[model samples]
Target: MYAPQADTRLLARALHAERITAGMDVLDVCTGSGALAVLASRLGARVSATDISWRAVMTARLNAARAGQRVQVRHGDLSMPWFGRTFDLVTSNPPYVPARDARPPTWGRSRAWDAGRDGRHVVDRICSHASALLRPRGVLLMVHSSLCDAGATLTRLEDAGLRASVTERARVPFGPVLTERLPWLRAQGLIGAEQDWEELVVIRAERS
Candidate 1:
């Protein structure tokens, strides 16, 4: 039971403006509702999308079918099975909510929103494999809450030898986070107490 929410419009704009063309290889990791993959298919790209959640995978397939597009949606862990497959483009909206109990209720307590105890588990893994997943000159696009450390993400990606940048920023309200962890984040200097409680960021990077 998924809704028809499409890929974030900003993401669509980036894809459209970029070099994605017919017959190019692409993968939309996370593939929630398959919106990005569907859009890629419409651009004539041979797209494959994967999600760990069975419901999300099925929903993506249904969404692609509804749009009369052919996107290969598979139920698999991020970047598995297709380990050796490099792509012209890879995208994801990873769970970066820092901690399971540290997010607000608007994020809905789903595993999809939580990023384990540190909120970096999924994203860190994505960055770890990004270089190997992309073709030469290929790109990786990801969005995460500012609650997570965007800089660290970029740093790790760069360490992997990929050219990374913050391509976009949006002040979307993510609702709220657990109050108990506030002191820890502040003490760790990861976030300031005066910082706005709700915000998200989108980052785009390219593989060398």
Candidate 2:
């Protein structure tokens, strides 16, 4: 059962809206079901997508077949050894939930949720590596949660020497984010322990 997540589904649509041109070498990290990869391919980018889950890899391939596009899908972490090279445009829609987040009953067991105790584990790691993974002047488009400290994310990218910017933001319905992420959220004074996941931001950064 493919569950439709706001971040996942919304990411593909946002990518389409970004008007990414043809022939761009795009890398979709944490590819999950490959929605972003397939969409980028349709826009004429040479796409390479990867995920940490086997099921996600299969789903991505299947979805690509249904969409009549070819995307190189691989089962791997943010980057694999064989994925040895870099790309012109790197994008990731990674898990932003902290460990306290109650595992969603819907999401099939995948590392796509709960980065670490802070929810920035994988997010920070991926953003930190973006510079090495991207070519000079390459771009990185990523979507994460305000639940994950959007400011810190931007700071990390900047620390990595990438000029970062918030391209979009939206308020969506998130039920458990308030309950499960409350402890950490309140610890950071991010949430009042009464607020849920209402806002998400799509970030765009470039390798300078």
Candidate 3:
């Protein structure tokens, strides 16, 4: 399972900054360890979480139970399981790492972070559909690496009629995966030869 990391903490902080309160319906997409789901539950929101990984789904369910929070955990790709449902808040920390291969790994732990080519495989999908799952005035809080083209995400959300902006940013050292792929990333012109740090950003989009 993908453990909670800096990106997770950052997204959680962003979520809290939105001042989510009781009675809000929250959806945590790609809910890995369900950290965000439990946090939303603790904040008194009715929480639901979804993940493509069965292991992640189980982990999220167990985490919610341990936290004494009731979260509906579903196993599926992105928001496929939540058709016809709308939420007050939608949050996600999807796989945004650019992979060497054109396709993400079908199985294994690498599935947690491998996104095809430009790293927008899953990010793009989230940007395209998250607004549809939100109620009026609903907010979407998503965290991803700057390497994935934050501008594109903002534009996509705006095109979908959501008011979008980058709400937070932090420069962090490269993690193991990124470190291992530095050479390839440089060759692909996705990163500078000397770059050793990456910027993480949280984009908040609101439905009017």
Candidate 4:
């Protein structure tokens, strides 16, 4: 199971800054461990969380129960379980690591961090579709690494007719995944030989 990390903590901090209120509808996509879901529930939002992994879904449900928070946990692709529904707020800390493979393992813990070659596999999906899942005046708070191209995300959200901007950012040292891929990433020129840090950024998009 994917445990809470810097990206998760950063997203939770950003959600707190959103000032989520009681009864506000909140959806947490790719809700690994349901860290964000629990945080939102604690803040009084009517929270729902979704994950493609059955393991993650069960883990999230258990975490919610252990935390004494009521969260609707769904098992499916990102946002798929919420079709025809709109939320006041949506938050995600999706897998944004640029992986060596075209897709993550079909059944493994790697699903929590492996994105396609450019790491935009899931991020692009969220950028293109999240706006459609939001109610009017709804806001989406998503966190990803700058290596995934934050500019592209901003542009995509804007193209989707949502006002988007980077709301929070934190520099974090390379975790095990990135550290393991350092050689390949350096060969690809995605990172310099001396680079050992990645900047995590939270993008906030609002639908008018």
How far off is residue 184 in model 3, in Å?
Answer: 0.3
Q: What is the C-alpha RMSD of each candidate to the true structure, in Å?
A: 4.0, 3.4, 0.8, 0.8
Off by over 4 Å in 1: 1-7, 100-109, 176-197
Pitting candidate 1 against candidate 3, the one with the higher TM-score is 3
lDDT of 4 by residue, 1-208 (tens): 5799999999989999989888999999999999999999999999989999999999999999999999999999999998888999999988888988887666788888889898989999999998889999999999999988999999999999999999999999999999999998888888888998999999999999
Q: Write the per-residue lDDT of candidate 1 for residues 1-208, one digit (tens) a residue.
A: 2332222665776777777788899999977778888999999999999988888888899989999999988888898957789999998876666653544223332656667656787888999999999999999988776667888889999999999988776664324343556666677666666864545556778877
Name the TM-score of candidate 2: 0.86
- Cα deviation of 155 in candidate 2 (Å)? 1.2
For candidate 3, lDDT tens digit of each residue in 32-108? 99999999999999999999999999999999999899999999989889888999999999999998888888789
- Candidate 2 residues 1-208, lDDT tens each? 1354777666776677667787888899988878888889999999998887788889999999999999998877677733568888887888777665444223456355766666787888888788888899888888887877889989998999999988788888765544655676678776665665568788888887
Q: Which segments of model 2 are wrong by more than 4 Å? A: 101-110, 176-189
- Name model 3 segments beyond 4 Å from true: none
Candidate 2, pairs of clashing residues: none
Residue 119 accuracy (lDDT) in model 2: 72
For each candidate, the alpha-carbon lDDT, in order, equals 0.76, 0.78, 0.93, 0.93
Candidate with better lDDT, 1 vs 3: 3
